[model samples]
Target: AVTRELALFKVACTVEQRAEILQIAEVFRSKTIDITEETITVEATGTSEKMDALEKMLANFDLREMVRTGKVVMARGTQIT
Candidate 1:
C-alpha cells in the first residue's frame, strides 16, 4: 500500500541563514511551522522517498533537530464502511 508521512525539521541556523533554509522548504513544497531568532521549524508531508530527499538536501545546514512521523492512512472520500 502507498503511504505518506509527515516530517518536521527544527533547524538552528542564524537569522542570516534563515532565508536560504526557507527557500529549501519552498523547494520541497513544505511549510514553515515556527520561527525563532535562532531557529526555523518546517513541516512537510509526502512519501517516504520524498522525505528522504528533503533530509539529504538539508544535510549541509546546521539542522539542530528533526522529527518524522509514521505513515498515516485515511479515507479520501465520504464512503463509510
Candidate 2:
C-alpha cells in the first residue's frame, strides 16, 4: 500500500502564531497525516536534508513548543484504505 496521496506533515506552532503560521503551509508540509495535536497541519514533500532544514527553521522561529510525532513517510499513491 503506497499512500502517496495520503502523505502529509502536521506541524503545531505556538498559539500566538497559529493562524499566521498555517498561512505558510507549504514551508513545512511533508504530505503525511501528522497525528499530532488538533491545532495545525501542512502538506509538503522533501528529503532528509530538507526535513532537517525544516526542523532547524522551526527551531529558529521558536515555533516548536512541543513535538507530537516523529517523521513518517508513506509510499507513493498509498493510503490507509
Candidate 3:
C-alpha cells in the first residue's frame, strides 16, 4: 500500500524571518497557501515520516498552528483477489 498525509502549518514570523521560513518550506516541497505580515500558511503532502521531518524543522520557528489529516492509502497495481 502507498500512504500519504497532508498538513497545513501556520507560522508566525517577522519580516526578517519570512525569507528563511520560505526557504525551509521550499526544502520540504511545501506550498505557500497564504501569507500575511505576521504569518504564513504552508501546505505539505508526503509520507508520515516526511511530514514529521518537516514539522521538526518548522518547530525551530514560531509554529503557531498545524492541521493534519489522517493517512490516505491506496493499493499498488491491480487488485488481488
**Please, what is the TM-score per model?**
0.82, 0.37, 0.94
Most accurate candidate by lDDT = 3
Residue 38 alpha-carbon offset, candidate 2, angstroms: 7.0
Residue ranges of candidate 3 with Cα displaced over 4 Å:
none
**Alpha-carbon lDDT, every model:** 0.87, 0.47, 0.94
Writing each residue's lDDT as its tens digit, candidate 2 over 1-81 gives 322222234455566666555545555554333434444554444554565565555554444333323445555554443
Ranking by lDDT: 3, 1, 2
Model 2: residue 18 alpha-carbon error in angstroms? 0.5
Question: What local lDDT does model 2 show for residue 9?
Answer: 40
Q: Candidate 2 — what's its lDDT?
A: 0.47
Predictions: Cα RMSD each: 2.5, 7.5, 1.5
Better of 1 and 3 by TM-score: 3
In model 1, which runs have C-alpha deviations exceeding 4 angstroms?
74-81
Quick one: ranking by TM-score, best first? Answer: 3, 1, 2
Q: Write down the TM-score for model 2.
A: 0.37
Q: Which predicted model would earn the best TM-score?
A: 3
